[model samples]
Target: MLIGIIAISFSSIFIKWSAAPVSVQGMYRLLFTSLLMLPFARPYTGAAAALRARDWLLLLFSGCMLALHFLLWMGSLSYTSVASSTMIMALEPVFIMLGAYIFYKEKTAAAAMLGMAVAIGGVVLIGWGDIGISPDNLKGDLLSIGGTAAVAVHLLVGQKLVIRMPSYLYSLIVFVAAAVVFAVYNLVMGISFFHYPSKEWGIFVLLAVVPTVFGHILFNWLLQYVSATTVSMNILGEPVGASILAFLLLGEQLKVLQWAGGLLVMLGLGVYLYTGRKKTAQSETALPSAS
Candidate 1:
C-alpha cells in the first residue's frame, strides 16, 4: 500500500512532464495499460459475463468518472502549482462521506462532522494561499476539486463491484473503458493521438504502468485486507510525496502559508479518518455477542 501511494504520488509529476494535450495524455496512458493487461484480462471474460446488469452499469459509470478525473486533474496542472493541485485531491474523502450519508443513509458521528468542518477550513486556507485572487489559479483549483469529486464517485461505485471480479481484471475493464472514452473525446476534439514525441510517449507509458497498473491495482487488492478509511488515510501521503518530488525535480517551492494550508489539510484528513474509524469500531464492537 505504501508502494502504491508512492507510485501514485509521481502521477502529477509525469503529467507535468508530458507535453501532450490532457485528453491525449489520458488516452495513451489508459490505452497502454489496457493493452498490457489484455492477455491477463482475457481469462476473466467468463467471470465478467457473470456480473449482473447493475454491476456492469457501476463499472461503466466508474470508468467514465475516472476518465473525467484524469481529464480535469491533468488539465489543472497547467494553471496552478502542483502543491495546490495535489492538496485539493485530498478532498475526496469528504465527498465520499457526504455521498455515503446521502445515498446509503449511513450516519456520521459528531467527530466526523467536526472533522469535515476542519477539512473544509483547510481547503479554504489552501485556496486562499494558492489562488489569492488569480483567476487562472482559481480555475485550476476548481478543476482539481472537480477531479476529486469524480474520483470519489469512482471509488464509491467501485466498492460494490470489486467483490465481483479480481482486482487486475476489474482494473483492465475500467482502463479499457476509460481509454475508449478518452479516445472518443480526443477524436471529437480533433486531437492527434499519435503525434507526441518519443519522450512524451515514454512518459505516457510510465504513467500507465507505474500509477495506473501498479499503484491503483495495489489499492484495489488491499481493499480486501483493510478498511477503505485506512486506504484513504494512507493516500494522504500522495500530496506530501508529490510535493517533495516537485521540489526536487521541478524546483517547485511552497510558500509558508501554502505549507501551513497543506498541513491543515493533512491534519484535518487525519482527524476525519480517526473519528470515522473510531465510530466504525464502536459499531462493530456493539454487535450482538451471539455472532
Candidate 2:
C-alpha cells in the first residue's frame, strides 16, 4: 500500500509534466498498461471464455467509466491546483460505499453518511473559494468531483468482477476497454495519435507503469487479500502525498481557505472510514471463532 500510494501520488505530477492532450495521456497510459498486462492475462483466456454474456457487458460499462475518470481527472490537473484536485478525490470511497448500498443492497453506517456530508461541505468551501478566483479553478474542481464519481462506478463493477475472474484478466479487459474509449475520443476530436515526441511518450509509459500498473493495478490485486476498508483508508495518503509532492516538485501551494477545506475533507472521510472499520470489526467478532 505504501508503494501504491507513492505511485499514485506521482500521477498528478506526471500529468503536470506532460505536453500531450489530456485524453491522449489517459489513452496511452491505459494503452501501454494493457500491453503490459497482456502476457499475464493471456494465461487466463480460458477463464475469460467461460464468462457469461452479462459479464462482457459489465466489462464494457466499467471501461467506459474508467475512461471518463481518467479524462476528467487529468483534465482537472490541467486547470486547477494539485491540492484542490487531489483533495476532492478523497470522496471516492464515500461514493463507492454509497453506490454499493444503493445498488447491491449492502449494509451501511449512518456515521458514513454524516461524514460524507461533512466532506462535501469541505468541497463546497473549496468550490466557493475558487469561484471568486477564476472560472477555470472552479472548472477543475468540478471535473475532479466528476472523475471521482466515474471511478467509483468503475471500481464498484470491478470489485464484483475481480472476485469472479483472475485479477490480471479483469484488469486487462477493463484497461483495454478504457484505452479503446480514449482512442475513439481522440479520433473524433482530431487529437493526434502518433504525433507526440519521445519525451511525451516516455511520460505516458511512466504513467502506465507507475500509477496504472503499480498504483491502481496493485490496489485491484490487493482487494483479493484484504478488506476494501483497508484499501480505502490507505488510499487517503494520495491527497497528502500528492500535495506535498506538488509543493516540492511543481511549487504548487494552496491558500488558507483551500487548506481549511482540505482539512475538513480529510477529517470527514477519516470519520467515515473509522466508523466503517469499527462496525466491520464488531461484525467479525460476533460471527464465529475457529476451533
Candidate 3:
C-alpha cells in the first residue's frame, strides 16, 4: 500500500511532464496501460466470457467516470498551482467515505468524520496559499473538485464489480473503455495525439506503466489484506508525497502556512487510522460465540 501510494503520488508530476493535450494524454496513458495488461488480463477472451451484461455496463460507466476524472484533473494543472490541485484532489477519500455511507450503508465513525474535517481544513490552507481567487484558478479548482467527485463515484462502482473479476481484468476493461472515450474527446477538441516529442512520450509511457499499472495493482493487492477504510487513509498521503515531489522536481514551493496545512492533514489521517483500528478490534471482540 505504501509503495502504491508513492507510485500514484507521482501521477501529477508525470501529467505535468507530458506536453500532449489533456485528452490525448489521458487516452494514450490508459491505452498503453490496457495494452500492457492484455496478456495477463486477457480481457478479449476469458475475462469477457466471465463478465455479465450488468458488469460490463457498470465497468463502462466506471470507465467514463475515470476518463472525466483524468480530463478535469489534467486540465486543472494549466490554470492552478500543483499544490492546490493536489491538495484538493486528495479529498477523493472524503468523497469515497460519503459514497460508502450513502450507497453501501457503511457506518462512518466519529473519528473518521473528525479526520475528514481536519483534512478539509488542511486543504483549505493549502488552497489559500497556492490558489488565488482569480477567475482562472477558481475554474481550475472547480474542475479539480469535479474530478475528485468523479473518482469517488468510480471507486464506489468499481468496489462492487471488482469482487466478481480479477483486479487486473477489471482495470483492463475500464482502461480500454476510458481510452475510447478519450480518443473521441481528443478528436472533437482537435488535439493531435501523435504530435508529442519523444521525451514526452517516454514520460507518458512511464506514467501508464508506473502509476496506473503498478500503483493500482499494489493497491488492489492490499485490499485483500486490509480494510477499505485503511486503504483510504493511506491514500491521504498522496498530496503530501506529491507536494514534496513537486517541490523537488518542479521547483514548486509552498508557504509556511501551506506546510503547516500538510502537517495537519497527516495528523488528521493518523488519527483516523488509529481510531478505525480500535473500532475494528472492538467489533471483533463483540462477535458472539458460536456453537
Candidate 4:
C-alpha cells in the first residue's frame, strides 16, 4: 500500500514534467501501461474469451473515463497551482463514497458521514489559501473537480467488473480502450504522438509501469487482505505525499491553513475507517444462524 501510494504521488509531478500536449501524454501513458500489462495479463488467451459482452462494454467506458480523468487533470496543472489541483483531486474518496452508496447500494455509517464532513471542511480550508476567482483558476478548479468525479465513477465501475474478472485483465482491457480514445483525440487535435525527447519518453514509460500498472496491482492485491474502507482511508495519503514531493522537488509551498486542511482530511478519513470497521463487525455478529 505504501509503495502504491508513493508511486501514485509522483503522477502529478511527472505529468507536470512532460513537455508534450496533455492529450498526447494521457494517451501514451495508457498505451505504454497496456503494453506493459499485456505480457503479464495475457488478455489474448482464454482469459479474454471469458469476459462477457457487458464486461467489455463496461471496460471500454471505464477506459474512456480514465483517459478523461488524466487529460483534464494534467491540463489543469497548466492553469492552476499544484496545491489547489491536487487538493481538489483528493476529493475522489468523497465522490467514491457517494457513487458506491448510490449505485452499489453500499451503506454509510454515521461515523463515515461525520468523517466526510470533516474532510470536506479540510478541502475548503486548503482551497481558501490558494484559490482565486480568476478565470484561469476557476477553469482549472472546475477541471480538477470533474477529474475527481470521473475517477470515482471509474472505481465504482471497476469494483463491479473486477468481481467477475481478474484485476490485471480488467485493467488491460480498460487501458487498451483508453489508449484508442486518446489516440483519436490526439489525431483530431494535431498533436504529435511520437516526438517527445528521450527523457520525457522515459518518464512516460515509468509513469505507466510504476503507478498505473504496479500501483494498481498492489492495491487490488491488498483488497484480498484488507477491507475496502481501510484501502480508501489509506488513499488519503496521496495528497500528503504529493504535497511533500512538490515542496521538495517542485519548490511548492503551502500556508499554515493548507497544512491544517491536510491534517483534517487525514483525520476525517481515519474516522471513516475506524467507524466502518466497527459497523462491519457488528453486522457480522448480527447475522442469523443457518439452523
Candidate 5:
C-alpha cells in the first residue's frame, strides 16, 4: 500500500512533465499497461470466459468510467495548478462513500466520517491558498470534479468486480477497454497516437508501468482486503504528495496555508487509518475462536 501510494504520487508529476496531448498520453499509458498484463491475464482467459454477460458489461462500463477519469483529470492539469486539481479530485472518496451507500448499502464508521470532514476542510485550505478562481482555472476545477465522480463510479463498480476475479485479470480487462475508449477518443479528436517524440513516449510508458501497473494494480489487489471507501480514502494523501512533487520538480510554491492544510490532511488520514484498525481488531476479537 505504501509503495502504491508513492507510485501514484508521481502520476500528476509525469502528466505535468510531458507535453503530449491528454488523451494520447492516457491512451498509451493504458495501452502499455494492458499489453504488459496480457502475459499474465492470458492464463486467466478461461476464467474470463466463464464470467457472466452482466459481469462483462460491468467491466466495460467501469473501463469507460476510468477512461473519462483520466481524460478529465489530465485535461484539467493543462489549466489548473496541480494542488488545486489533485485536491479537488481527492473528493473522490466522498463520492465513493455516497455511491457505496446508495448502491451497496455500505455504511461508514463515525470516526471515518469525521476524518473525511477534517480532510476535506484541509483540502479547502490548500485550495484557498493555491487557486486564483479565474475562469480558466474554474474550468479545470469543474473538470476535476467531473473526474472525481467518474473515478468514484469506477471504484464502486470495481469493488464488486474484483471480488469475483483476481486483480490482474480484472485490471487487464478494464485497461484493455479503457485503452480502446481512449483510442476512439483520440481518433475523434484527430490526434495522432504515433506522432509523439521518444521522450514523451518514454514518459507515457513510465506512467503506465509506475502508476497504472504498480500503483493501481496494487490498489485493485487490496480491494479484496478492504472496502472501496478505504481504498479511495487512502488516495486523499495524493494531493499532498503531488503538491510536494510540484514544488520540487515544477518549481511550484506552497504557501503557509498550503503547508498547514497538508499537515491537517495527514493528521486526519492517520485518525482514519487508526480507527479502521481498531474496528478490524474488535471484529476479529468478537469472532468465535478457531478450534
Candidate 6:
C-alpha cells in the first residue's frame, strides 16, 4: 500500500511534464497499459468467461467513469496548482461514502456526516481561494472534484464485481473500455494522437507503468489483505507526496490558504473514515456472529 501510494504520488507530476492534450495523454496511457497487459490477459480468459453479459456492461460503465475521471483530473492540472488539484482528489472517500449509502443501504454515522461536511468545506475554502487568484484556478479545482466523484462511482461498481473476476482481468476490461472511449472522443473532437514528441510518449508510459500498473493494481491486490479503511488512510498520502514532488520537481509552492484547507481535508477525511469504520464494527459485533 505504501508503494502504491508513492507510485501514484507521481501522477500529477507526470501529467505536468506532458504537453499533449489531456484526452490524448489519457488515451495513450490507457492504450499503453492495455498493450502491456495483453500477455497476461490470456491467463485470465477463464475469469473473463465466467462473467455474464451484465458484468461486462457494468465493467464498461465503470470504464466510462474511469475515463471521465482521467479527463477531468488531468485537465485540471492545466489551470490549478498541483496542491489544489490533488487535494480535491483526496475527497474520493466522502464521495464513496455517499455512494455506499445510496447504492448499498449502508447507514452513515453522524460523526462521519460531520467529517464529510468538514472535508468538503475545506475543498470549498481552497476553491474560494483559487477564485481570488484566478477564475481558471477555480475551474481546475472544480474539474478535480468532478474527477474525484467519477472515480468514486468507478470504485463503487468495482466493489461489487471484483469478487467474481480476477483483478487483472477486470482491470484489463476496464482499461480497454476506457481506451476505446478516449479514442472515440478524440476522433470525434478531431484531436491528434500520434504527433506527440518522445518526451510526451515517455510520460504517457510512466503514467501507465507507475500509477496505473503499480499504484492502482497494487491497491486492488492489497484489498484482499487489509481493511478498506487502512487502504484509504494510506491513500491520503498522495496529496502530500504529490505536493512535495511538485515543489521539488516543478517548484510549485502552496499558499497559506492552501495549506490550511489541505489540513482540514486530511483531518476530516481521517475522522470520517475511522468513525465510519467504528460504527460499522459496532454494528457487526452486535449482529449474530457468522459461523
lDDT of candidate 4 at residue 64, scale 0 to 100: 88
In candidate 3, what residue range of length 10 has the lowest lDDT sum? Answer: 220-229
lDDT of every model, 2 decimals: 0.78, 0.81, 0.81, 0.77, 0.89, 0.80
Q: Residue-wise lDDT of candidate 5 within 126-152, one digit each (tens)?
A: 777778779999899999999999999
- What's the TM for model 1? 0.86
lDDT of 1 by residue, 214-270 (tens): 787787776555544445555666776787788889998666665565577567667
Q: State TM-scores per candidate.
A: 0.86, 0.85, 0.91, 0.90, 0.97, 0.84
How close to the true structure is residue 196 of candidate 2, measured as C-alpha lDDT? Answer: 80
| Model 3 ranges with Cα > 4 A deviation | 42-47, 220-230, 282-291
Total clashing pairs for each candidate: 0, 0, 0, 0, 0, 0
What are the RMSDs of all candidates, in order?
A: 2.8, 3.1, 2.3, 2.5, 1.4, 3.2
TM-score of decoy 4: 0.90
lDDT of 2 at 101: 75
lDDT of 3 by residue, 47-131 (tens): 6797899998999999999999999988998888788887788788778887788888888788777986787677667657788
Q: Among these predicted structures, which one has the highest lDDT?
A: 5
lDDT agreement of model 6 with the native: 0.80
Considering TM-score, which of the candidate structures 2 and 4 is the better prediction for this target? 4
> In model 6, how large is the Cα lDDT of residue 248?
91
Per-residue lDDT, model 6, residue 145, is 85
After superposing all C-alphas onto the true structure, candidate 6 shows an RMSD in angstroms of 3.2
TM-score of model 3 relative to the true fold? 0.91
Top candidate on TM-score is: 5
Q: After superposition, how far is residue 127 of candidate 5 from its true place, in Å?
A: 2.2
Model 4: residues >4 Å from true position, as ranges?
220-233, 283-291
Candidate 1, residue 213: Cα displacement in angstroms equals 2.2
